[model samples]
Target: MSGTSDLEFFNTQLRSFVPPGGFDAHAHLYRREDAVDALPRHVEDESGQVGWTAYSRALERWMGDRRPIDGLFFTVPKPALDRPAANRFVAQEVRPLAGSRMLLMIHPDDDPADIEAAAMSSPCVGLKVYHVYASRADTFNAAPGEFLPEWAWELAHEHGWLIMLHLVRVRALADPVNHDYVREHCRRYPNARLLLAHAGRGFCGQHTVEGIEALRGLDNVYFDTAGICESEPLKAILRTFGTRRLLFGTDFSVSEERGRCVSVADGFLWLSEHNVDWELSEFGRPTLIGIESLLALKQACRSARLIDADVERIVCCNARQLLGLRQAATNQTQVTYRRAKRLIPGGTQLLSKRPEMYAPDRWPAYFAEAQGCEVIDLDGHRYCDMTTSGIGSCLLGYADPDVNAAVIRRVELGSMCTLNSPDEKELAEVLIELHPWAEQVRFCRTGGESMAVAVRIARAHTGRDRIAFCGYHGWSDWYLAANLSDS
Candidate 1:
């Protein structure tokens, strides 16, 4: 099933990266008879069937020591395929495989009665809806509602079942219509767990990166690292949703294929031995798509600074929890820190406050409450004032009685309004009186903004564009310009 190069690549590049046992969140299992026509060239099984045995054998060939113990299995969703027979094949194949589950394939127009019967009779965990079932010829551009009808949502909601949606459109998740549909449907059917496959079909990483913001805070929503071969989309998903919501997957059959999807221009393109001349390439021959996907995931985990436990959750624990199976324990602080690295650049707003500046993984990266000189972390561990004290901003020792009373009084009187407060004039008078040489004062919100304003005033008054000063004044453009080579 795999050549010597595949074995070498697995040992050197993917062995340590992949954990002991994984759960493939996305995969297919069916026979040739299930399809209306010949199967795609990517299906490499000579026996004309790809059941649990075939899948296991394929993994053994390339995975070496690490392979998925279970998978979320489904059948090929061709428009003209025999739906009943295909589903029966899937049900039979996965029934005896403990911890493995199957999703019933359905079209928009399918009879709900029949679907209900199949669900009750078999161990079907959810539904697998595809675009090919749409009425239009160009199903790639079909909307989610076109193929996945409202009835499906109702059924899923009523049963609390999951829906593995492979979003398809020109821009995928980046499209506003897709965003609106996902947001509305998710809100409407709160009980139906929506698993966005392929990181919301993020073959083009930009689509996911640009559109992931809209789906944030939707607890029912989740993502699977399926056939995606790039780290950008995975990193974006990890940043938005922690490791618990990001399930590891191998889009098998396709994963067995030798190729990778690359982002090209506004869309994505697939490169395979059939489409390109591997012999003429400067690099070595292409490995399995599965291998490429694993490498990309490892890179994303490294970039996001995910711990071993975080990686374990993505590869094994998350899927188990989603499937109503037992899950491994995880630390909340580590989970939050991983998310912060993805959301906040350098993992913190100020470099001095970064966890790496303290103890990295061992450091408590967040706080639940603060009072006086003591702070309580998420796990309720208390620490007294010993270090920078909130980067010197908390010299008053956090939530001081006088400061708290003054803040409360100001807030009660309305801290902000359409009209300027008379307090500004009084503050200006006090500042000018403190420094007799100053005639007036300009107020700004932060140190960086104040620095920028000061630089502008100095340039305008002196009629000179350049000035020399040192020692990290602020993050203003003028101050940061010192970092440039020509400066």
Candidate 2:
């Protein structure tokens, strides 16, 4: 009854990609009485309620066989809605669904004690504060602190609960105010997990891309792929945060709706059946918003070079970890390797270090920290260096104390300047002293660039382009040309 015409679309486009036993990180649960205003037509159920059963049935219609194992449920945070009733409804509905969790819809004016009492009474895992709860009529432009009071942050920090924030402001994360708020608050409340809904409300895509840098090192922050119909923002998230930090969310009832939000100049516009004439389009027709979101996610994952395991993390494992639910143990090294293959050509910058060059999937392709001859991997396992020893570059061993001290001193004093550093001249003089036959010296950052320069100088001096070369000199075209018979 649900998927109907879209069943073909789902089967053809998403059936294989949509892994089973996944979790929905974001979804809504409530009844008619919870809202003072009428519910959206798509979510209006004949049973006078839209709980787990209704949600499952609706999901079955559209998703077919690829149903989520459980979901993080919340209620519509309309300005005039009865908040207590909504929370009660969600709590009652999800009590039987194992692994399903709910959040208490909180207003800025609500008492912290009541909020805490509600959380204690119910199985609510966190707080869901909305922009509509702000005191201003134009809540869209409301500052973060106006709707989400400091007490909520303090309470969440103390209890280690999550705060699902749907960011506002015309430019979303691109706005300096929004960026500062997220950075400062997240840093201040280290224990509270801040789940940014809709990928930082990245309807414009550019907003998320531009502002994602500000949130780079904030480990407590995370994002949800809920109702975003574009790939750019999702790609930006995956690239910046990697697979573990990005969670899959349907935005549920909104996902069931027929229109989507598209980026316009500087802002975004929601194109729904009510706003646009579908008959006038040259394209066939609009699919469900949820379907469009999945398509965008699929495209982003493909573009980001995510493997199946990476997809599983986004769709299922990440949420389980966030919710404290038990999940299958994953090898962090292998996971990082799979991600590397997708993001990096040959899974590494150096051909010698490629995972395929050694033990393949079993190789430790990355390290979290390195000291002397021992290296620590992402999973916290340590190893002794029996191989290249930092590809022979770190002959002094990784993080040698003398080298680190010099680098740190230079960095602290400002490593770069508009003018050349005197250290360059001193280093060149030292090199010249080492080789008495050479009076002048030039420097290049890498061996490849230096080899190219050397080739250019030799060719210029002798007026000859051809020369005999041997074994693994560099990546310069001059060195690579040996493979070509014509060359």
Candidate 3:
């Protein structure tokens, strides 16, 4: 239903939102010009047509706003193609785009040391295992671990590299043997983090959910939403993985043609020595249906009610985190914090609560809820309050039941009205009774404000321009004035 190069249409659809610094987890870029000569007689004619410039234009169009995007670049796997040459092309080509990472295809027979040497010599961040291609099968139906070498895992574990895995067999999760094989392999190579392509290629939502559940306890396992556009499945992935393990991918090139009508002359579908047409012919007729990957993804996200935060995480945060690109992956929180520093003086209301007081770069400075010495952070992770319970204000502990109940009762009776509540006066009298020297008292919401009031009273009573105080007196103009002149 979509036109070729429908940039304008995509722009209109995405006008309301733009995820800044988003990463395309799955994308392709390579020099195919030389590969044409090496390809088989039948399909060799099809090679060398798509160049990097055309690829760049397509990326610009996909990016929509002409703003560059980061991606994990790869070369499409083919039998006759020189794998090392492809890796060299991607590494050299993507050097300018420092945000992008490269993943090269690794076969079982490839020497691990040579692969490692090549990786070290290039800008590669990981390896991709094309199960179907490596197995020399028309479709992915064999167990991945059955063919993958242990040396690949050892190298990845040593260097902390990612393995962009595409599993074989449609019912991978349902098949216990396949699931256990992968589970055991992951356990053996704990450091070689794996990201499943196309949500393990589960076409249906329930199957996708089941497949994700299969790798439930594997902390290093990840997934990407590329050719998958089903809303229910997207929702299931988001719900199960929490956006941290789900990466955003368009599967580029392939996604560019997705869901678009293609003529018989298209090299990908028509010209192939491997029974290209007959093998793909559905029973009797020659028909082709495109998968509108990008459009469908946007629609799925909208349908799933995923907010900007989740979208940003999937499109940017997760990839950056996985790649250990902390400097490059500017998340929504960092963006907001940067803006706040420019707009808000000192960046926050309370100096102590400023991001610097905690992990600074890593700490989540915002909270959603606080109850009984526990805090739920902005990202929904809860933590126990072991540190000084709100600067020691909560002497009875945070959110004490008795204290909350009294406050609730007072609110129910009437927190404020034409006259002050008797409780304030009773408390003042009680304080005086407890300490005879304390004749008067004032109730203020914060210690800092109370300290400012006290400073003003001291200045007024003593009729002095300077006053001396010991210890930290909080952030108040009165205290700040003392430091106006050099001691």
Candidate 4:
């Protein structure tokens, strides 16, 4: 009863089933002692009592509705002592993932050697650490600094282990120092791939852009969606880094939040399309929407994350590249042309977006072939060609013999040349004749070229070698010199 875009379609499965051995390295599993104490705080008053049985029942119901969520991460509910306690807790909650399914968590100060030994003794498909919890606990990190055991890196790196750290932007933690620690950890174990949970946790900002920028060079870093509610900061992060470095994470633990986890994720569904608006999304679970909505949502994601290639950098390539995971080589290329890039950089990028952020991704396809004033798309879609050959491009109708002849003549005459064509001189003459006051006519084919030429001209005319630009004005000194120039 649910469409592809409907959260119910996905959540229904999540409620009924778990992913086949999929692993979530960032969930929390408190001891019964702790669950009894903590579950009450988060359990929705409407979901019934908050006890281990109730929590377990709710979780099982969700899992049974959804099953085998690859694996769910369960952080230690504090009050853990020594490796034995942590190991015992894992045995009770996470050790179920013996062969392939895994749910792993590592406290910052937990001895990595014990964790390694436990992995050897049992199966731990993935590992997680909680910075968000730490923040709530009033600590800058979930565990002490350099939380990874000395040998943890060596062991995890050697085994191609997938490590997850709940690294939030807890105002105080996202720093050069913390980034350095992570980078150093990565450097120590070259094969170590780490996913930073919550895309570095910007809930209320214990940090700033400067903090995120601090880790610019660390290629091994990754971000997964959790509590992220906005696409703008995510867009900036994707742009600052790359969309490939991003992973789709829904901290589904928010089932206790005001809206069901499905509702929250539904709010994010618009992020999947090219013409959606989150404001338009249905905010509830156990309810079905439609496929058109889903397609629209994903369409937006395809672009919002890419406009500046930031989306591509974050959502698709970066995580796989850094983690050494391979994606299904997509035959489809989300190539945004020069015009789109001029505005949206990677073409209006965001991790979660509305379809409108990416409609350009499907231009002619969304509309059928243009016939004079009309055009249509594959889905029996239709639209008006408002500008029929208005730009003299034979576009959207107006293709006549005269236009054809003119185009053929230009082509045959070789109007485009490696060097400046005589056509340029003739065109300049016509322009100058028309204006009379104009002194120069610059011939550039594309926006990028024109922009570069314009900058060069301005710099020459003003005798000021320095300049500034904000958007995707490539080929300009302001852009090229951004990382190099004295500016």
CA lDDT of 114 in candidate 1?
92
Q: Give, for candidate 3, the lowest lDDT window spanning 10 residues.
A: 261-270
The sequence of per-residue lDDT tens digits that candidate 4 reaches over residues 1-487 is 2223334444643322222223232344444343433233544324332323333444444234322233334434343434355545545654553322343556655566667776777555446554433434655434424444445556667887767665432342355656767767877776767666655654333242346666654545666655455443355454455444566443534432322112232122222222434456577233212222122223435434335333333333433333334343331223323344566644434322323443645543233233344443433234555543433455535334366457768877876766865766888999999999889888777877887787788878898775666765534555555346554
lDDT of 3 by residue, 160-228 (tens): 999887766656554676668778878988888888787666445556656555665565788887766
Model 4 sits at a Cα RMSD from the real structure of: 18.7
Candidate 2 TM-score, C-alpha based: 0.72
Candidate 3 clashing pairs?
A: 258-291, 259-290, 259-291
Q: After TM-score superposition, what is the CA distance of residue 167 in candidate 3 from its true location, in Å? A: 1.2
Measured by lDDT, the strongest candidate is 2
lDDT (0 to 1) per candidate: 0.84, 0.86, 0.66, 0.47
Candidate 1 shows a clash count of 0
- Judged by whole-model lDDT over C-alpha atoms, candidate 4 comes out at 0.47
Point out where model 4 deviates above 4 Å: 1-25, 34-36, 40-68, 81-112, 130-138, 141-146, 167-174, 205-208, 252-255, 259-439, 446-487
Candidate 1, 188: how far from true, in Å?
0.8
> What TM-score against the true fold does each predicted structure earn?
0.69, 0.72, 0.59, 0.47
Q: Per TM-score, what order, best first?
A: 2, 1, 3, 4
Q: Summing lDDT over every window of 10 consecutive residues in candidate 2, give the lowest-scoring window.
A: 35-44
Supply candidate 2's per-residue lDDT for 456: 85
